[model samples]
Target: MSTVPPLLDGPQADVQVLQALRTTWSDPPGWLGSLRAIDHKTIARRFIVATFVFFLLGGILALAMRLQLARPGLRLVSPEFYNQLFTMHGTTMMFLFAVPVMQAVAMYLVPLMIGARSVAFPRMNAFAFWVFVMGGAFLYAGFALGSGPNTGWFSYVPLASSDYAPGKGVDIWAQMITFTELSALLVAIVLITTIFKMRAPGMTLGRMPLFVWATLVTQFMVLFAMPSVMLGSTALILDRLVGTHFYNPARGGDVLLWQHLFWFFGHPEVYLIFIPPLGFISTIISTFARRPVFGYRAMVLSLVATAFLAFGLWVHHMFATNLPEVGKAFFTAASLAIAVPSAVQIFCWIATLWTGRLVFRTPLYFVLAFFVILVAGGMTGLMLASVSLDLQVHDTYFVVAHLHYVLLGGAVFPLFGAIYYWFPKFTGRMLDETLGRWHFWLFFIGFNVAFFPMHLLGLHGMPRRVWSYSAGLGWDGMNMLATVGALAIAASVMVFLVNLAMALLSGRRAPGDPWGAGTLEWSAACPPPPHNFDTLPVIHGREPRWMQQALPSHVAGLAADAREVLVTSALAARPESRPLFPKPSVWPFLGALATTMLFIGSVYTPWAVVWGALPVTVALIGWFWPGRRETEQALALEQSP
Candidate 1:
């Protein structure tokens, strides 16, 4: 009875139906199937989670440093431990936490906002995550083994060499940088491809979200700028490991070359971290304020201009290093040029607040805080851009203050704001508003308290990286105040963690569009579907989902189900052929495992490096393998169906 009942199945019928089902369910050939399987949301979630973990690790390192510096001349840990702490702290926070998190948020949100299913190169996206994980592990293992990089995150040459440091610490730094930058570069490539190639039917580049545009600019910056530093690190690694003379001053190696390469990537890295956050602030302000972004064109142009200008100003970091007067003046002028774009962004943000309805949600609070703190940092940056002023403040607490203000305000503040804004979308639950407010207030106040006095300390002749200083230097009161602020910031972070945990565990369910967000992501399920949308909606303008809601429900639903195709250009409204969705595979995870071994093996023995290379090569080959001829024939039929 079972044999006859199920689709009238004899062996032939059974075979036919099985083949038909396989044809129905199977994905197309090439890497596309693997890519489609991951989807944008999964990739984005991976990016966010991995980055958050790195943030926790980096934050712990920060707390350790703070404890050590809490008092004058009191040793909380050994000097070596302190060195590793600061280096790992800076490296982890900058490379692992800040930049990747920004990209992750963008990755998750951008395609959804634009009404696309997945990013271009979804497999590559998975690969980037694996590389980042491997890189972080390597850094952590190196630290545990007492071989953590000690040449500072920048890893100046002579200090990093075997002659001076005499260990594998610098090697760890170089390798970590290599792995992380490779990850960044991969992400950049994937993002650029997605943004340029995969917008919904009616979404023009001009009509794209400001955050999308900022991300696009950021990807280009990452592609061009990151490689320079990667190259520099490679050079230094060679010099350390194989007796190359690239940075060996005694052997005609120029330390300045290291400075050039580092800052070349470093200065733009500042914007790379800041711009996405700025984009977030822009989007949040406009949404909460209930107004269009002020000077949208200007904001977009400024972002582009900033990327270009960022490269020319790297020499500003070298002002105190006895560079030629001509070189100094060139950098000084280039440094000042950066102020133009920054000022443009600031003015636009202020204008947005002034004109918009300006609701004071938790996210908006952080944006407001960012405005105050960022202005303070920008002013210092302007001052530092001046050759004489930079010379006076270089290597001082002022520099430290300036960087923290910029990073904390520019990156961290907005990062919190983004978390608040998007928490509902990620978890399908609303974060506790009261706790969020508490977190914002505590963080904002504590942040200023911790960093504001550093400017005074810098002016009073206090230098950065000092283990301790005498109480008689008039730095005691400020140091004590700073410590208090640091503790407060730590408490605020604790509150955030608690809030996140509670929200995930038992928070109230959220609406699809909790904030009345204009983006397409808000139109879907709270956490979104695995495919993101059942059908991608055609985006006609900047606020597609918001506009969709204004239409009759049936009309909007019809619009949502249109057969979405990727487009190359807005002007022509050309449609590329629809492609099949990706299917899940173990290759990405296996590849990550191989890469991890390579990094970890390098730390243990030189022979381990050789052995490590084999797995990576094999995994990559398997990852890209075309499969059997029979599988290919079956896939070709499946693709047509």
Candidate 2:
């Protein structure tokens, strides 16, 4: 029999390490306990669930939009309601759903794939989830009170000014922006730190999994880019409440400032959403095909180049506003330059598939769809990047079509693939392939049917964001077709939900490594143990687990030992031997509740903001405060057995 030493029984064992291990394995608190479970898997699941809820809400808003615009003179909703629907729809999907879902997948899977016990900052992960939940609730409650934000998702200035809006609507929008961005920023920091510092031993930078690299790049982009939008929104809020003139055009505020600030964050935001999905596709493709990613070096370099180039292309969104010709040319060139790296990635993916033995699975189908749709979006983007072309098609249905293709195709499609791929890992049961295939084809066809005709409608000169249109423009057929497509898409989504429900209830139980994936996540028990691994894994190559499995057991045992190292920094790789990571607490939940009160209070009474702020601040401070007992215990445990 194999004799493994008990970790808790070691003479030199640290008490805090034991405490932390116990905490990590403890049953999550009821209702609130669920929130405190900071395991990467739990956090990731929370991210997916919360974001999916927001996605449903966002989709409902989209349906409302389609109903209102079903025909040229349909009065399904008022102009004001239409504005709120689109605005909230865009905001919810982009900020609340797309980014968070991507991040959630990362949070859950990255640590397992990279062979780490938990993320670098577990508490921060908990905090981000709570804050995001609170933010979404705030926005939803605002709508319930008939004060839904009507500013476009971008909330362009003057239109968003207090005088034009003159209500609590803009405040709700700004606060939602603040709340969600803050959560995203925290996630970015956590992921970046974890990626840089927490990989298993021998996992060099170049040898790091492609998903890790993609996440690293995306997090850096979020870290730097999110601030510009946050600052701009804050400025807008100040203008509304304190009479600041930053974006108030009549008071010497530049209307274009909002554009600059928004796109600064906005352009990179596209890549932030897309890159992680791309990473997911890369990992899934290589694993199922049993091949290393083609042009791995080139793929990594392309990601780096794309990250740098993304920031420079934001002004392409503002090309129609009559900027100086020189500035416009600069942005246009920058925008075109951004496409080169994307093309490189596409080429690399194609090469990988061409050389490898391709496995045709439901996930692979989604990846294939992603490639097709993303390419269409990229072509439209190239068209829009040109100053002349953009001037003609700006704010038209072309832009709408382009945005949907990129966001939905690039982010949502690949994410669906990832969910199907990882569902077994999360639920301990395989998702029904037959049902999943149905979901994929229906969504794929419906999605194309819905958005494809928008390009033609745009070319025929249908401006976007208009609640009603005149029927004689020859636009009614396409609009009606698009609505039908939307319903079809909805139906497909329903199928997916039903499939998920059936899978959870009584589908075939999954086996460990069902897909023969290369990463360490597949090495563990399906639905992995509460503490992940009893012993940390040793990573040798990008496909560590696969390589380990190929070797003899004795060799694999040695490899595991060699791979095991405390998570630490990339610069030094010194082990952070401290044990007993912070245990779960009710503080995050309490903090979120208090903050929600503050947001709702501000909407009704200005002084309510003050009252709301106090409890939230107190709750946060309490949450972060290190109780003397735990601190001393931690210190003692770190010092001695």
Model number with the top TM-score: 2
lDDT of 2 by residue, 1-641 (tens): 11122343454344444344445456476876785666667878888899999999999999889877779898989999999999999999998998889899999888887667678777778878888988998899888889999988989888998889989888889888888988899988888877778766666787788888999999999999999999998788888887789986677889899999999999999999989987999998897777888988999999999999998888888887868899989988888888888888889888888988988999999999999999999999989988888889888998899999999999889999999999999999998999999999999999998999999989999999999998899999999999999998999999999999999999899998898888778877888876566556655577876674443321111111111225655844345543455666777677777876786666555688777788989987998898886677555544543
Question: Model 1 over residues 1-641: C-alpha lDDT tens digits?
Answer: 01112344467764554344334333344665544345567677778888888888887887777777767787888888888888888898888888888888988888777666677767778888878887888788878988888667887877887788878888888888888888898888878877777777677878888998899999899998899999998888778676789987688889889999999999999989999998898889988988778998999999999989988988888888977999888888888788899889889988988887867799999888888898899889989988888888889989989999999899999989999999899989999999999999899888888888889989999888777677677888888788788888989999999999999999999998888777767888888765466545666667775574443321111111112234455343345645443345567768877887786566546576789989989988877776575355445534542
Model 2 clashes, total count = 2
RMSD of 1: 5.8
Question: How do the predictions measure up, each by TM-score?
Answer: 0.90, 0.92
Worst 10 residues of 1 by lDDT: 554-563
What lDDT does candidate 2 reach at residue 111? 81
In candidate 1, stretches whose alpha carbon ends up further than 4 angstroms from where it belongs are 1-37, 548-573, 602-611, 627-641
